[model samples]
Target: MQLVLTVLEIVSPVFILALIGFGWVKAGHEYRIEFVTRLAMTLSIPALIFVALVNAKIEPAALTSLLMAATVGFAAVTAVAFVAVKVFKLEIRTYLAPLIFGNTGNLGLPLAYFAFGDEGLSYAVVVFAVMALWSFTFGVYVTAGGGHPGKVIKEPLVGATLLGGLFLWQGWTLPTFAMNTLDLLGQIAIPVMLITLGVAMARLQVNSMGRAVALSLGKVILCAGIAAVVGQWFDLAPVPFAVLVVQLATPVAVTSYMLAEKYGAQAQEVAGLVVASTFLSVIYLPVLLGLLL
Candidate 1:
């Protein structure tokens, strides 16, 4: 009961309020939401990543585990998504982005922080960086069909990751003032993302709910199961391994909708997946935490 309550306390009100705000103001205004999401994707999120990775103290071995879990989960999901597209004859153009881009930032980061503290958060950051790269490049290609996927290489996150990598390689640290400023900017990224997500959710149609539910379950349950088995084999600690599993279990990212919109995939369908996964995450997250923690 206490665990259940804790989960509810942490997740529900934020989501509920965001839903209400979206319904009240932004449901019909997709453009407005898109503008804000772009700001996050292009600016605040990258800053957050830069600060997190540059400052994070990562063990070489731990980094290997983190990379392993991310790679395995990505491969598993990609294979499943391939099968999904083939079996359903899904318009190859439409389903590819959501099929690949699971919610790593919003749902995954928080759960990782809660479960394994800063170390888990670092791992989640690495996963987010990886997903962002793949989502922008291959995901765009899959969505655009005949267009140039090369444009994805120029995205801000890609540049930021390169810069951050330079810093990591050099063992560089930011000055106090610079670190503080980046942290301040980084803090805003998550809440803005959540509120925007709520706004996006307000626009979802009831008829689309079933498909979204199925997709969300596929991400959380199927992906998480694969992560757990692989993590155990790799001998990851229970907490960190569980953090990876839960991160896999997070909802489809709002970024999916944004990317789908930008690339001309089924944006509304992607949005529905984001909203549905988030709503269901309220239940699934706690259940997962109970079992894993």
Candidate 2:
């Protein structure tokens, strides 16, 4: 059907870019993931967020509604994840954060753009900003037992979100040349992020495949369900509603595995979740997009 092809067209480039990174690593090429991640986070992604919000054509009220809906959806996810962790007697430090926070940045953003175009990117960034804020603050606390709140403000993503929101509120625009330059920098974010995702997956060692698969499946279902309910509850427009579901339903972030490693909370298990969830996304995302479209 035309819908199936539409979903494939939207999803193909994302996975292909990721596969390129995966293949690059398998070919024994050197990729300094940390350096690339720093570049994207510190420069490119911020530019993308700022530019997207500044230029978005949608009304601020709709975006505000989406923002609140995303926050509530995340909160609901955190609550359910906590209950599931307790009921299952899983390790709180390791499983909880991964279950609560999905990969809204790298995977979610590009998918939104492809599926719903620039306006979707605008909506997606709001969700990403919410995720970034929550993950940096509460997610870090969950894994590390405590974290510096001030450090969240220091993040470039946070700065961009705040600055972008300010501009959106005030109807401010940067000079044309500056906007073009930022737009050019912003363009690198998606391809690089997709490739980095593939590279990370290629390098990750998944332990406990069964548990990882189960958790990943559970996460997708729970997140998508919550997002769907929240989007309807908030009366989101069609595009924003669909974008919300996709962003929240993204796989476990590679950052979750890194955090687990840094905090000594079953890093290999977290790695397993990351790998399992990402692979599962390749199958389920297209199907989900088909239904959403």
TM-score of each: 0.84, 0.99
Per-residue CA lDDT of model 2 for 1-293, tens digit only, reads 88888899999999999999999999999999999999999999999999999998888999999999999999999999999999999999999999988898989999999999999999999999999989998999999999777889999988998899889889999999999999999999999999999999999987679999999999999999999999999999999999999999999999999999998899999999999999999999999999888
Q: lDDT tens digits, residues 91-158, model 1?
A: 66766667677778755665566566667766777777777767766776787665455766777766
Stretches > 4 Å off in candidate 2: none
RMSD vs true structure, all candidates: 3.0, 0.6
How high is the CA lDDT of each candidate model?
Answer: 0.72, 0.95
Instruction: Give the worst 10-residue stretch by lDDT in candidate 1.
Output: 23-32
Estimate the TM-score for candidate 1.
0.84
Candidate 2 residue 70 Cα shift, in angstroms, is 0.6
Flag regions of model 1 displaced more than 4 Å.
12-17, 20-31, 147-149, 262-264
lDDT of 1 at 216: 73
